[model samples]
Target: MLVPLTRQSFEQLIPVIATSSQYAYYWGKFPDFLKRLLISVVAVVVILLLKFLLGDGFDPLLFLLGIIAGLYWFWSPVYWASRRNIEIRRYKYSGFWQGRVLDVFVTEELIGTEENVNNRGELVIVENRERRLNVEVGDESGFTTLLQVPLRRTHKGIVPGQIAQMVVMSNQPDLSRIANKSDIYIPRLNIWVSDYPYVQRTVFSQVSRQLTQAEEDDYPANRVVKTRRRRR
Candidate 1:
């Protein structure tokens, strides 16, 4: 899912070009069911053939292991996320792309279920919270980029129609509107941003102190006394 980001918020908005790369790199090459079915079918066929050839000496339990391994190899979300995270860090980690905040909003939670494998690899059931963001970018253009990002991956608020900036790799600089950009070193990605505002405050206060002769040397005091009694 694409993360929601506005410069007004605490997170960064998804980079227009990077989002495309994100999907192409992260999501399953095929639909989940299709991939799972392929894994099970191929593994079962191989396991059955092996058992038949080896006689009863071979354990049928090997079929389950084969299915698990095949599924992990081809369609595991954990594996994909891990790899994608690494790629993002390596490529889009330092450089930044700045743009105006066109829009900011939240999306309905996506309800779904996936394998709830624990650290020990035990299966369980749990509801997944797939938060998403849909932000339209581009101030003036025939085409605008709609950025879809996961909320969990987002945390910034520049507000609607405000100037926003974020990190993108040097290779995909075309993704952002503004060009001639350079590397902006920041800690993380996916945030909201906006134009800075003016604030008013009182800065000075009265203070008591004693000054020595040297401290007041710049302002020399000269006094003269004159009497005009005769003129009276």
Candidate 2:
């Protein structure tokens, strides 16, 4: 099933910025507070270096830099949130597509390497491995894609035949060819698996209900038309 999205379908990103783990995850686990602190530290270091190199006459330039840094620190979160909102808005005309889970599998992924001290007091490189769950889904038109997430105890119940919905962006408004990646939502499990938080949950739930109702209403009519054709 495919349904076009409206302007209201998108939520204000600023309100949910702090609550989104996916946003923080994309920045290598740096939370908003940490980001502010890091930026402040770097700005101070740069100003001190400039003072050492240029001597006393560069006070005005250093003051300007400080103001810029302060403004950036204050508005950084809003800037990032706006960028994310724009990404989702690009797919608004492409419509939402619902597909069925064709298969489900788990794989071990090497996320990174950690340095650990062994019993002999020597640093050893330890590979950090994580279990990832992959769900293969496809629409009636045979368009398929894989949705992956970290395998957690909460995700153990996902299985084949579950409904997976996502915004399908395409150059053609008809969605003949996909253009970008989108967040996936599994309505049955109330689980959203995505690399980023692109969809507004409340709006998505309302749209999903409307689509399901339309499908239910069309079922009997479709069966009646088939029966009449058979009689003919």
Candidate 3:
């Protein structure tokens, strides 16, 4: 389901909006709400088992901290990678749009797992890669919105031009954004590849550039505030 960013639409939809629908495509249950609950229950069960096996000598406080850390390690990616209004950004509202891919590229990342008893359990090193795909789209006003979608997988055979669609949400003024899990529909291959869905394009490129520069015309001149801070 798609909802526009207009005030009236946002007002009417927030109450009825099944925020989980965005994630229902993957996790039939709630990823942020119910999923978290299940994870907590399981962690509690494991901790309980450990306490039983270790007997009265078990330190609940330390076990609680371990549980917290484990939860962080497990759910941080779910909460971070698929975050919505939780983070500060140019956009708060979500909608939908259709577009095409103008270019495609891949970013190789080494995703590995290591376990330890006395340290930050699993060490995660995300090697950032850029220049994945070029997507061309138009808004309701018919202005071109160009998006650069970073391919999340290896060896994604995306061409320079292809048909695709997205569920887009725009921020205020010159900025707008899409969802992170929203897939790029490739009609030719009848397949969807894991790639960046949170794309942004200024309503007017020149105007966006000017505002960016004017924002730098200050005591901190020439420095970016990095308002739309994203962490994986």
Candidate 4:
């Protein structure tokens, strides 16, 4: 089922930024924390090098620039969060769509590697593997997509046939086709799975609740209409 979303709030973007930063290496890439640290270190090194070369002639503007760079590095997550929001807003319309979980399975995935030292003091590269849950979901529109997330203890209860919902954006107001990648939210598990944070989750949850309540209220009335037609 698809329900139109008429409102969105950016106030919850702080949590989205936090989640994205926390899962920076979700796709086996360099972690955001380490990346920011590296940037800060590089900026400091460059500033010191310029100071050493210029002796007493060093420009204070260089120092100010280095500080600005550091601030930008720290604020990168917020920048990305705002970009995601703008991307979502570019669509003519957006809606919440609930589909069924067609399949659920777990697979071992190599996330990265770590260095370990043996008793001999020799460093060895140890492979890091994580269990990932792959879920296939589809709706009546025949649109099917696979979502993968690192398997966690709390996610052990996810099974087939559960309701999975996502924010669907489209260039057309009717939302005939999806215009962007949306994070999947499993209402039953109360968990979200995605390569990146794409939706303002708090708003999504509120919309989901409203849609579910509306559906429940309409079911009996629709059933009564069907029964009356049969009697005729």
Highest-lDDT candidate: 4
- Pairs that collide in candidate 4 are none
Tens digit per residue, CA lDDT, model 4, 1-232: 8776664432342232435443353323457667776887788788878888888565787778778767755666666666665655666677778886777777778899999999999999998887777778888889888878776666666566667788777777787887764778877667887656666677778867766654434432211111011110
**Which tens-of-lDDT digit does each residue in 113-206 have in candidate 1?**
7778899989988866654554554434343345555554333432444333343333332433322221211111223321110000010000
User: Could you give the C-alpha RMSD of every candidate to the true structure, in order shown?
Assistant: 23.7, 10.0, 14.9, 10.0
How much lDDT does candidate 3 score?
0.43
Instruction: List candidate 4 stretches off by more than 4 Å.
Output: 6-35, 51-60, 70-73, 80-92, 112-127, 213-232
Q: Number of clashing residue pairs in every model?
A: 38, 0, 3, 0
lDDT for position 115 in model 3: 42
TM-score of each: 0.32, 0.69, 0.37, 0.67
Which segments of model 1 are wrong by more than 4 Å? 1-38, 54-67, 70-75, 86-93, 96-98, 103-159, 163-165, 171-232
What is the clash count of model 4? Answer: 0
What is candidate 3's lDDT per residue for 26-50, written digit by digit as tens?
3333555567666767777777777
Who is ahead in TM-score, 1 or 2? 2
Each prediction's Cα lDDT score? Answer: 0.39, 0.65, 0.43, 0.67
Kindly give the stretch of ten consecutive residues in candidate 4 with the minimal lDDT sum: 223-232
Error of 3 at 127 (Å): 12
